[model samples]
Target chain A: MKRALRLRPKGLEKGRPETKPTNDAERRQLMTAEGEVRGELRRLRARLPQVTGALAASADGLVLASETDEAKEAEHVAALTAAALGVALRLTEATGQGGFRELLIRGESGYVATYAAGPTAVLTLLAEPRINVGRLHLEARRSGARIGELIRGALERPALVPRKPNRPPSLAGP
Target chain B: MANTETALKEATTAIEGAVGAALVDYTSGMALGTIGGGKDLDLNVAAAGNTDVVRAKVRTMELLGMQDEIEDILITLGTQYHLIRLLKGRNHSGLFLYLALDKQRANLAMARHQLKRIEADLEV
Candidate 1:
């Protein structure tokens, strides 16, 4: 199965933290256009009673958008999730595990469900204690396909317009 | 209660002293639906803990190069029994239903039999 996220060499230059998209000039761009993505994810979250929040993060730990108040911290979680995915994918491949599907982390307070949106993005759903597991999977699975399409579109070309003010290209450069 | 709700309720009621019955995503250790998880026993922890069980078994299978899927996993404790049933459906992958039962009050065989039936009729 094709994975939603890919692992690059450790030494590869990573992109800078995403600039907040604000102005119409930057908002018009596709790659950095987070409004639509965030809206869709928000809608998806609404459908899943178990999902307290949802976010789409790049495999490299860039937070695209999130519905939770802690959207900013999504970057941190994404980075660790990316690392785990890298290890899990490699292990699956080395031993001939059929395909990489989904990744999950459970904590004392809640559950984190990660579904591969494509080779570049992961859709994470955070659920409270009452969240239904079966329903979440069904819901996240649907959103994953949609999010995959959106992310894949964005990745087709790097968003040319910069969202941050007068930022040097070096920020995006490796 | 609706039809689905009725089914779930009936299933839980059939098992004497059923602590919790959840439809869990083994791939992500998320419990889809849970009934009867009290403050003392957190279903979320149970779901995540069983994830390790599923992963260990899958990894062991890989090491042995065995390609068959796991049907179910049964963990027997002194006072309770944890049953993990992998839901096998075209749309259902990396998912399972976890049921915890009081050992003294539960009939293991009956619980397993009923779970299989519930799994078959599960919508997702």
Candidate 2:
């Protein structure tokens, strides 16, 4: 079940081969950060009467942590958030808007919301249609900021590693 | 049953001074169908870009604690009126209909009414 829940960044795999080797370690750090964010999400859900679920995901659509029972649904939401983020960023830039902030979709059953978490991640929440939008935004914006910091820290840690000199090409071909 | 492509075509022809119309998936930022766009206005780009406007308004509503559903979002340029109508049907979730109209020749109220009618007849 855990394996099934691992979020894969299918959209970015093609251009990021160099980041592969450190994936395991980076994933560990991210998971730790995610754990903290998950705790925050849980608290937010507990305080808000209408929130049904919450998730933190990377900008590329990898799920960091989720506070929902339906893992598959969370995965799909995260991917969609990433896709939405792409267009949102472009829209803001093109229109002279400051930055990509948040997105909300209202349906007959409920509301789906996404907030920018720093530069590296996003926070998505699902809520009952009757939920208080003001309170949801207040708590969510705070939580999203913290999660963003955590993720940004995790991403920056890897940069501190000492770089090894490029190896000389082997003279003999096997 | 009416389909997305037919509905878009009908939107451009039925609405006066319509430059283009499109069915867009806000989730994927992709246009499912488009009609009537040319060199000055690109329906695909407009469709994709408007997803943000829809998203921003929704977020603002959440922040403002407003509970009312959005009927439609209207953007008026010097020569154009961009109308975005969110699809409320079960299967049409996350999708919206976007129509760009020439301001001089289009009747805003009637265009909105027609778009609403078109939205009801649209099948995904």
Question: What is the TM-score of each predicted model, taking all chains together?
Answer: 0.47, 0.47
Error of 2 at A105 (Å): 1.0
Model 1, C-alpha of B52: deviation from truth (Å):
26
Cα lDDT tens digits, model 1, A26-100, are: 224433548778988889977765577788875545666778768556767767776676676667657866445
A56: Cα error in model 1, Å: 0.7
Native contacts recovered, each model: 0.11, 0.00
Q: Any runs in candidate 2 off by more than 4 Å, and if so which? A: A1-24, A156-174, B1-124
Query: How good is model 1 by TM-score?
Result: 0.47
**What is the per-residue lDDT of model 2 for residues B47-107, given as tens digits with 9 covering 90 to 100?**
6568767877888999999988888999999999999999997798888899999999999
Q: What are the per-residue Cα lDDT tens digits for candidate 1 across B7-103?
A: 4565688766578877767756666667777997777767766766787798899999998989899999999998988878788787777888899
| CAPRI quality band, candidate 1 | incorrect
**lDDT winner:** 2
